[model samples]
Target chain A: MIQLDHITWNVSGRTILEGVTVAIPANTYAVLMGSTGCGKTTLLEILCGLRQPTSGRVSLDGVDVTDLEPRERGIGYVPQDLALFPGLRVREQIGFAPKLRGMAPEELNQRVNRLSEQFGIAHLLDRLPDMLSGGEKQRVALARALAARPKLLLLDEPLSALDESMRAEAVSLLQRVQQEHSLTVLHVTHSSSEAAALGTLHLRMVAGRLEVESKG
Target chain B: MRLNRSNLCWLVLALITVSYLVFWALLLVATATYSTPDSWLQVLRSPEIRHATFLSLVTCSLAAGFALLLAVPVGYLMTRLEFRGKSWLDAALDIPIILPPLVVGLCLLIFFQTKVGKVIELAIPFTYQVSGVVLAQFVVAAAFAIRTMRGTFQHLSARPEDVALTLGCTRFQALWHVALPAARRGMVAAFCIAWARSLGEFGPILVFAGATRMKTEVLPTTVWLELSVGNLEAAVAVSLFMVLLAVLVLVAVRATGEKV
Candidate 1:
């Protein structure tokens, strides 16, 4: 579960998110819909610990993670740009977190192989991010994020850069993966169609406040 | 009868490009032609020239290494951090790059006479020494390295590092694993720029380290010393040798396959 209690983020004496509060249940696919420049990304960033809320609490899996670093929060993030490490190959990128955590070499290899196979990027393990297509890069980014096995996954406009066909494919992939892993996801997008397609719990943002639209 | 504006623009650009290329070519050709092959060999093989050559190589390498050591962290900080007086700090860092080389050397010379500098000198000598050559070179070279590295870091997106941070890595680990590797080509370019700048540095070394043959004399100081005594042949020979070394350094860097 992910919870934001009375979250308010002010920048330069202007509020980006004001008195915002919401709860996303575990294993729920929560789509946060808002117009451009409506603080959707900022809200996601706050939840991921990339940005701090001015006055509020962020809880993940019933633990208060407001003061915790991103790594300590046990959250996976895919930024809008799909910021894959330019220097690392797909395999290395996927295995990066586990390697940092001192996972045994055999276990790391097994995990990487499993994720690659599951994400259908096994053939691209040796390729760099630049060599991959947009959809392939998306898959690699998703696989890389999930390799760490975080309690919550936060994606900021992950499908915004893809074409219609690629978006459909990515939406199906995300849905299947979330179901298979029972992953709690908070996906920020401005597209209502995307919200309708993938969200188990729908939430909307208006003028920095969150309103729960529907619950599954 | 009349050229179009686009054609005129192309003509002017091409003329300037060719003129610059020809100027550099003529300078190399004149230097190479001024000295006889035998004199070139003799100048290169001479004991004093050999010592100066070795010292130049050693000092320039040290200067470049030191420059990189200072540049990486400074560049990263300048690019990644936002603080009060950041603009002022940025301008301050450019002082070494913009200051006249002779003035920089003079400052170094005067600084050693100060109390803090005297205390530092007691532990490690820099005035009128080979170390002083490196110090002079580094002061100038590090600025260029820092500028290059700052530009390098600026061109890189912060998102990768942010992603790394969320992936069970601390800030330092993210820097080590993600930022450094991404900046590898930039770092190499910075090192080469610093190394080449150090090799060609003359005014600072001349003013600070002094032109002592077979001791503190670097390639630039060697050129100055040879020219001072009316040894034009030896001076030109050393100049051409410096050119050759610069080309070889560039070639070696390219061979290392650090292309982005």
Candidate 2:
């Protein structure tokens, strides 16, 4: 499980996330829905070790990884921008994490091939990021993050960049990948429809606290 | 009536721009004969000229390379982190760039003249030595390199490194594979400009290193020495070579620009 306990995060001496406690159980997808400036991305950053909270703890799989580096937590996060390396070809971008973890070349190649096929991105493996369409780039980013088989996957506004038709395709791709990897996902988005479609648990960020919202 | 006004504005702008451009072009290029066959042969055959050119190439390349290597981390620190003295550090990195080259040279000379320079020399000396030229060049060129690299790091999204860290890459590895790859073109532009700055460094080499012939002379210093000794042809020859090198760098600059 991925858990946050009484987490308090302040930026520039102002509280952003305070006394937030939550758990994302294994193999379950949770959606965090809120209005803009609600600190959803900041929460994801804290979980992925991109940002450090002012106080409190983040735990993954029963171990406190609050102070650990992002790489040590076995958690994966895709940011709003997708953060694709612009100079690299799609295949290299997707294989980047595996390469860093020092996986064997044969294993990496096999993993890249398998994920590429799974995401319907086998044809885009050789193209650089600037050449790829928005949807293609999003798939590459997701594929790159998933190639490591992270214990917890964090998706931030993953469908915001896609057109209507592409979003339909991507929602299916996302569900399939989450199920196939057996990942516990905490997807943060502003869209209620997206939340309803993919998430079984709904939480809202209000006044820097996580609360179960009534959908009346 | 509207077309007449627009056409008149366009004609005046074109005329003024073309006139200035043609004048500047002729000043630099009309001297094609200034780069004579005999001077080329003379420069090639003269051991002093050859030695100066080689020394310039070696010292400038080394200084530029070292500056770039060091600037990557320092620039990262100044740009990406928030320390107690971050604003001060940012301002400090920029002081050298804005200081007149001659002033920077004098400051460095004083630095070497003091106890701090003495202690540093005990570690890695730069007092009237061959290494002094490199030291001088690095001081000036690194200022430019740091500025360039700071921008290179700024052009980066910063999210890639964040993602790489999440994906199990160490900070250094993330810098190498993710941010650096995305920053490839900027780094190349920085390298070219820094090297060019090193080659053109005259004030620091002259003041701190004393422009010793065959030992401390780079292209700019060689040009000065030639002019002092009344060898205008050789001075022009050296200047011509410097111009050619600058052209090569600008071509690289333009190519890199188009790539990004």
Candidate 3:
């Protein structure tokens, strides 16, 4: 479960996110929809601990994580750009988090191999991100995010970069993976169709204020 | 008519570029041709020239290494963090680059006369010492390195490091694993820039280190000392050698796959 209590973020005396509050239940596919420059990404960033709100409390799984660092929050985040480490190969990229956490080499290898196989990127494990197609890079990013096994997955405009064909394929892959892992996801997007396809709950942002649009 | 105008514009631009290229080519060719091969051999065979060459290489390497060590952190801070007076601080970092080399050397000379510098000098001699050569070189070299590194970090996005943070890595880990590797080419470019700058540094070394024979005689100082003694052949030979070293540094920078 994720709970944000009256979050407000201001930059240079300009409010980017107003007093916004919402809750996402565990295993819920919550899609946040907002127009461009509506602070959708800022809200996601606050939840992921990338940016601290001017005033708010962020709780994850009933634990107060407001003061915790991103690493300590136990959340997986995929930024809009994917932000894959360019220097690391696909296998190394996926294994990055676990490797940083001092996971045993054998266990880390097993986990990386499993994720690569699951993502259907086993063959591209040795290749760098630059060599991968847009869809392949997306898969690698998703696999890298999930490698640490965070309870909450926060994806910011994950499908916006892909072409029409790739978007459909990515949507199906995302749905299947979310169900298989039983993961709680907060997916930020502008596409209503994407929300209908993936979200168990829908939320919208209007000038930084969040409103619950629908619930299933 | 539009096509003719475009062609004329391109022709003018090309001529201007070629003129600058020709000027540099002429300077290098003239310097290379100034002295005979026999004079170059004699200069290279001289014990004093050999000592100066060895000192120049050693001091510049040490200075560049120190510059890099200082640059990485200072550059990262300048790029990644925002604090009060950041603009002022950024400008202050450029002081060494902007200051006259003679003034910098004079400042160093005066600074050593102070109580703090006197205390430091008691522990490690720098005034008119071999270490002074490195200190003078580093003061200017580090400024160039820092500028190069700052440009490097500016070009690199912070998103990868942010992702690393979410992936259970601490800030240091993220920097070590992601930022450093991404900045590898930039770091190489910075080192080469610092090395070349240090190679050409003359004024500060002459003032602070005093161009002592076989002790503080770097290549630039060697040229000055040779010219002071009316050894024009030796000076030109040393100058040509320094140019060669500069060319080699440029080649190394290019080999790193970074823009020269």
Poorest 10 consecutive residues of model 1 chain A by lDDT?
A43-52
| Candidate 1 second chain TM | 0.94
lDDT of 1 by residue, A1-216 (tens): 988999999988999899999888899999998878889988888888888889999988888999999889888999999999988999999999999999999999999999999999999999999999988998999999999998789999999899998898889999999998889999998788888999999998999999999986
True contacts kept of each: 0.82, 0.89, 0.86
Residue pairs in candidate 1 whose N, alpha carbon or C atoms collide under 3 angstroms? none
The numbered model that scores best in lDDT is: 3
Best by TM-score: 3
Alpha-carbon deviation at A114 in model 1, angstroms: 1.4
Model 2 segments more than 4 A misplaced? A214-216, B1-23, B29-44, B119-125, B258-260
Deviation (Å) of A126 in candidate 2:
2.7
Q: Clashes in each model (backbone N, CA, C under 3 Å)?
A: 0, 0, 0
Specify the CAPRI tier of model 3: high
Candidate 2 lDDT tens digits, A131-205:
988898889989999987898999999889988888878888878888889998888988888888888678899
Q: What is the lDDT of candidate 3?
A: 0.93
| Candidate that beats the other on TM-score, 2 or 3, i.e. the better one | 3
| Sliding window of 10 residues with minimal summed lDDT for model 1 chain B | B251-260
B1-260 in candidate 1: lDDT tens per residue? 48999999999999999999999999889888887999999999999999999999899999999999999999999999888999999999999988999999999999999999999999999999989999999999999899988988999999999999899888889889999999988888888888999999999999999998888999988888889899999998899899998897787557644321
